[model samples]
Target: MPRTGEGTTVRITIGRLAEITGVPASAIRFWERHGLLPVPERRSGQRRYPPEAADRITVLRTCQQAGLTLNEIRELQEERPRRAAMIRAKIAEIEERRTALTRAQELMAHALKCSEPDIVNCPKFREEMTGWRPASD
Candidate 1:
């Protein structure tokens, strides 16, 4: 009995919601199955979702796009005992990865600009390439 923006109560079918939100129906069902989503009421044996479910799916997709695993997103979404601790841990992990990726990008940029045919042969790069092994065996 949830009211949408039109001052009237409304419910959308799973397929319609999926098309509106760009989330697959199967993924919505999977999230519900895995406890990430609330179970919807069935009208005429078809799932019907409230408007709030769209916002929840948006947040879930955003979290996944930001590199959070399903378990991590679930931890953040749930009313759990250790939510804060888990959030802190995930933030730390993401920060570490961001720092590493930044370094890698900078290295690639430098390599691309270097005039040397083989970057490893350059004096500046040679010092940094110490003990680096070739990827191919």
Candidate 2:
């Protein structure tokens, strides 16, 4: 890491960038290949990133945790005209996943109270399955 004059033009090597971002160097390079991170300036053959790269990596990590694919993250980063559409699509996907998870929870809860030797043979469980519809439908 190197700083020049009151942090107005500070730069850090790739290793330092990874240290601050908690991302592996290989992963950072991968993102650069995929256009997720802008190519950094090279100082004496070593990649030197501005302090802001850490913030960009944080955003990438956050988006990944929120279930956005790398391509989706790239689209968001590029600020394409279809950004809103992509977000809406992701929201719909999350809603469907939530619905499926809720249904699974209900089934598990019922299983705990079920007295039948086999849950599949339980009358209540059978009725529930008959009425069950996938979220996509």
Measured on C-alpha atoms, candidate 2 has an lDDT of 0.90
TM-score of 1: 0.78
Residue 132 C-alpha lDDT in model 2: 78
TM-score for candidate 2: 0.74
Per-residue alpha-carbon lDDT of candidate 1 for residues 60-100, written as tens digits (9 for 90 to 100): 99888878888989899888989899888878988888877
Each prediction's RMSD over C-alphas, in Å, is: 5.4, 3.5
Residues 28-84 of candidate 2 have per-residue lDDT tens digits of 999999999999999899998989899999999998987999999999987689998
Evaluate residue 125 in candidate 1 and report its C-alpha lDDT on the 0 to 100 scale.
73
Name the weakest run of 10 consecutive residues (lDDT summed) in model 2: 128-137
* Candidate 2 colliding pairs: none
